[model samples]
Target chain A: MKVIREKPAVIQRPHNFCAGCSHGVFYRLIQECVEELGYSKRQIIAMGVGCNCNLTLSKIDTVDKFQCAHGRAAASATGIKRMRPDLLVMTYQGDGDCGVIGLGETLNAAYRNEKITVFTVNNLNFGMTGGQMSWTTLEGQKTATSVRGRDCAATGYPIHLPEIIAGQFRPAYAARCAVYDPKTVAQAKKYIRRALEAQINGEGYAIVELLGICPTNWGMSPVQAIEHLQKKALQEYPLGEFAGGEQAELAFLRQEAEK
Target chain B: MQMAKKIMMKGNVAAAEAAIRGGAEFFAGYPITPSTETLETLSFRMPEEGRVFIQAENEIASINMVLGAAACGARAFTTSSGPGMALKQEGFSYAARMELPYVVMNVQRWGVGLGMLDSGQVDYLRDTRAGGNGDYRHIVYAPDSVQELVDDLYEAFDVSQKYRMGVLILSEGYLGQMMEAVELPPFKEIRRPDWGLDGTGEVGLKQLCPTYNMALAHELLPVRQERINRVCREMQRWESVETEDADYVLVAFGLPARVCVDAVRRLREEGCKVGLIRPKLVFPFPYDAFHRVNPNVRGFISVETNDLGQMVQDVALAAKRELPQRNVPVYCYTHSAGVPRVQDVVRYYRSVLDGAVKEVY
Candidate 1:
């Protein structure tokens, strides 16, 4: 077969994530979107501290990249985009950084409708710090902190960021996606691309949550981890556009019916 | 009423206008008492000048916003008071590590912890030192009057950019709230350094904390030290009040310095050879001014607003370093959260003159 698409120049080095890590896949997709959007040189990204730092470590760069103090990426991106309205500003963060440490920053950035794109990877736990329980850890999910599985009564229910943000803040766009299969990966890319588009059109703040699997932390094979995500996690986090869609629920229902 | 071009402007507002004249293009701040006037003034003025200004949700967010703008090479700044200044410490460390330059105006409130909304110099130590985690010291400007505040801030951005480090303006609530006939500087051009983030990645990835590399830091450490030494060598600024031929010298900054001047004049009239050393830049703590003091100077006193007499420590150190042969005593006169009256300061100096007040160092 003839070689067609090549790796993005932005991905200058091999990433340091684990064997079944989804960070690499997500970073590649983001680079693709920036490339496709024709802002390959006119964009900047602020990555919150977490696995997102792997983007900088692996040399996944933009015109400029800021390794913002953990959880301050949203606020930092707010500053960047506001100062240079001509440049496309984006923030990449993990669930822990977004929901746990940087919660105020995330919500306020959305509330202000800052013209920046936000991408949060929800791996169910704080994967980088050896699978500690996170704000997004599913109920009854075991981790470093919650050895007996998560207790919703004690820790509160798993946070649904896109839904909360879409409902409360009325952002330009908000969506959740999974990367278990090729089709889902394509759908996740669509959400990411749409989130970028909303910012491009000056619609205001946009966020997309990508639900990816962690085989090492899940104590399962990569294939089994994907299965776990499909059979169990999917029930909790229904994938669809949550905001900025005319009939998001209806489209979600139709998508479920097709499956 | 505007007197010629000099307006009777509040200190904080004058500083805000001076920042605009000095080429600060971006401002992000959380409203805190004492410093809120600066934020409020900039909120509307920035838009009128077609610059960027944002009221962030909290102190951390505001400083981080400034960090982002500074990274892009915009002249950015933020303002806050005591507790709010504490919240901004993390962002300060991050900016320091990134070697990004920006200005922060702290209209200092009194006391520790939550402190009070009272105008005082309680933030002197924190503002003069690293003020955050790790090892970094930025240039600190301690302005006494509204005109001095305007003048200091007007040059602050350029100084920060020149050194590529944070520059702190230590403003007290007393100074911030009071009005003065001030002349603001004329508008200057905003600068975007060649190293600043432009649309192109031509400079390559502008790395954060290059000092993290031990090997690179081995070479970088000396350069960093030299910059600090150069700052000390070049930026020690102060105002002298009758210290040319005096047996006793008074060391102070900001509001205390203002009162100390009056106290110095009164003491001089009372047949006491007392003078005042008003430091305009606290971090480069005016050792040079000690050169102008009497060679046979009998003693030095630190006049301040904090209950504990914070700046006195620096007074002792500077005296020890600069007046090694004199071996003179260092005294401290302080007020608890309130600006001391000139009468009170003069009374304290009389006690010192009579050997009734003990020296702190």
Candidate 2:
């Protein structure tokens, strides 16, 4: 007998995201991974003050969810893990929430190699705040704050988070993925599963940066948003496991050889 | 049976030791002037007791860590001075809303906006009145001496948890940096709460959410307000010395209270009718203690090391409740950040008694 589907960790509740928002896909993928990993009963999540974060509390009533101060999900998660190391703890943050305002907490948590998972929904702009320029906003991209297209000179450049995490020795896993289409959605699921697995195994900090869609904030239709991710986001933030590059491959090879 | 050893140590170190004795299993703190030794002591001592200690990246992170640990049923605390305490306001507000019981120490310093790293009590208003924005109040204890600092911290954990609120020990640098011999309390083993967000993975049990946003506002706000009011009423603690039989009452707290107490004794020895009323618990202001004073006490003088008396308002209000018929003279003698001069306090008490100091209208 083959099982094609299983229940997810998220409870059956209506989400509050805008139509065509990719946050729903990320949420579903994360819940599926949690359900598969048998962490549904012992999962604790720290939610950032953002649109996607709000849905996790309202929709995902099954798991314990803590609401963190804007951009302080990492710090709060660190507290949970330190106090209750036996439990699985993770944080859900957005581009502006994780990258700019809470960059200190985010980076320090990774540097400390805290045994937790961080899932960042990078939508290029601050979606909940009506499309303001974020640290992850693309060059030449026009947001409410970046009226004349983001100037590379004035706003610097979009921060490459996975690249930065990969450069660090603390994070055992760090990857960038998108959830635009069916294939990419499946790939995003794998990234989320692997990140959770790393935390479960106490392999130090793990992070998965998901290039999510904000159709309303981007001023695009569902189709246009998918196209933008496929064409632009994928080019700028390449999808792959950036951190734990050699260690993960070697472990995989060793396991295959042993088998 | 062996008695506890009394060792001469700085007030900050004693505070750290007292926290450990009080069963604080987790300490997340950032180093700041006057209060740094408290964190430094806990950094090494906490781990020895199988506790968690983290020197956080900043004050903001430290306080957030406290909120996290406290949510999971761990006794956690943090210590800082003026600038660091200012940075922790956001986390404190969150802790108050979530009702995460913990302790925070503000070793007072002079000035505002990166003020000098010396002894000062100008932060009395901020520390006792709302340190953070909101209609929330913290259980603030102003310990005047090294022994009082250790004693307050020793019982701070239970008191904080009893009310499910944050407790603050507002000690100035003079006490925090000074050394005194004191007996330490025995270690306590705190029982874990049944309702914690640790996700024990047990069946038929739901995970707990510590933030107020997750709960319905209309349902939670009223309950939270009621809990706060009840706790405030039950946690009012203070001390009144010679106030029962005196012509004039002197109100002071923290470091200045020590000076005022000494000044009162000296004034009494010199055949002057003066007494002291010191508030151990600054928050909930100990209004009942003022009402207990002799109605014959014609005046009240508030002595503080802050710029233009902060606690004077509370003192006057308490006195007003005591004597509703006639206007009682309330005088404020402020010294800002400078070290207290006992002579100055004595002179003010004499002037008020002689009717030389005009009543503050």
Candidate 3:
């Protein structure tokens, strides 16, 4: 008998996401967590929508997935979770998708502390639909609409989602992490793992905000974009745990249950 | 015949009972008038069943919490009315677009702003057609009696789960406050699968994630719409009554439908040729069924409790497409402050039958 040693569900689709996009990194991290957790491919239900919406359906093959509408993936995931509490469900959203169009959903999910993990990629700008200033865009960040730097007086201040969510609800795990470099990327993965593990433990809502680089939208080379994220974005959006993990022993026990 | 126990249950309580009996283990809702009872009841009962219940700070957060719970594969629900429902529009839209199976109870009151907790069906149009800004439809069920309210709770969850769509239980202030005898179904414990986001079991590393992006979203629209259409076609169930020998039909839904039925019976007894068509599922509109009855009926009367007869417009559109050649004149009885009584509906039906009614639109 031949033994297969690959994750059952990831498709071999060529990566269309731009370099330094961080979506690819996020996807890999989620895939790694699922693989390590040892869940059956068919048991995993995924939903996605908006700019980075179809990323999962095109790449992941081992799980049941649904592509939802703009900023509505959380809502659909809510329904899925209600109907099939046995299936691992999660939603990956972008800053524009989650913060602006989906702010209500993000806040509500956190407030209710629903047992789902939200992976939010904050590139500050809307990367997919030309560079546009999103709600999370920094005050001086330039974009298609704000050819001039984003003015605090005109565009409002950049939203700190993790802080806002932490204030609203006690999620099982909440953190703002980055993937601009190897160390932070590893840290981000750990946070991602913690959030997903929270779901497995029925610990309620978990979220990870990845301070990602939008090379295309930022008008910087991939290397320059990483450097920019490290220097400028990290200072404004610090990376650290926002909630839970106080019971490290309990979390580890629950994490081991997946293996 | 056995005497049914008279339960002085509010509409919200009935809805809550139905949700609990139907195996809803997760409920997140912010308190609002007319619908607050549903959340209040769930807050106490869910924990008894080892379910998750949260009283969110606001309706926006309430609906989002529902989204989170639903994503974890739990049977989740939320309840609100008028303004609260409006606030929840974004989350509701997300639920529908994401193809999530959940139930929302809307105890509608009058309004464009902070519509008072009055007995009006003003939200019929918004809830039925365009609650959120997008090209999508929700499975809307408008129950008239307290019994229907309770029965439809289970039906709402079942339909939502089967179709992967959001189901709206549109109740009004009258129904929410009215007391009626109800036979409660035996409660059954819902067994949640390991995939729910509750984080209790071993999660596989390959589970799908919920995320939105434009490039990926565009590709799924065609498939998603196709799925929606399929669900709409298969699950378009409605409560309809007709007399084969009748000449006219009175079309209504929710509480107004009950009034229409009373009016139809009174008109028929008075030697008039009028019947009734009460739709239970208001979203899928029952166009084909309406068309089947359209040819035989001489005219139609639309009864609602809104300032501008919103549902009447749907009847007109259906009549235009269903019975184009038939001169089916529609008379609307629009009242915003309160639901028109049975006598009021009967009066309108009689006038329309007597050719003495004036067309408002």
By lDDT, the best candidate is 1
TM-score of each: 0.95, 0.94, 0.76
lDDT of 2 by residue, B1-361 (tens): 8998889989999999999999998899988988899988998999999999998899998898888888787888999988999999998888777777899999989888998876888777787766677767788998888889989998999888877779999899888999999998898887775656857433211323333554476667776678767866787778788988888888888888888888988998998778888998888788888777778888888888877678888888888886787578788887787667889898877777677877663
The regions of model 2 sitting more than 4 angstroms off are: A1-3, A245-248, A251-259, B200-222, B353-358
Tell me, by TM-score, which candidate is best: 1
Mark the regions of model 1 whose C-alpha exceeds 4 Å error after superposition.
A60-63, A245-259, B1-4, B204-208
Pick by DockQ: 2 or 3, better one: 2
Which is better, 1 or 2, measured by lDDT?
Answer: 1
Fnat of the models, one by one? 0.75, 0.59, 0.23
Indicate the docking level reached by candidate 3: incorrect
lDDT of 1 at B297: 89
Tens-digit per-residue lDDT, B181-204, candidate 3: 787766766755444333322342
Q: What is candidate 2's DockQ?
A: 0.56
i-RMS values of the candidates, in order? Answer: 1.5, 2.5, 7.0
Tens-digit lDDT string for candidate 2 (A1-259):
8998755735567677788998887888898888888877788888888786667545545567777788888988988899988888989989888899999999988888889999999999998878999989999999999899999888889898877977865688999888887888888888898899888888889999998888998999989998988899778888888876445779899999999
DockQ of each: 0.67, 0.56, 0.17
Q: Which pairs of residues clash in candidate 1, taking residues 3 or more apart in a chain or in different chains?
A: none
Best by DockQ: 1
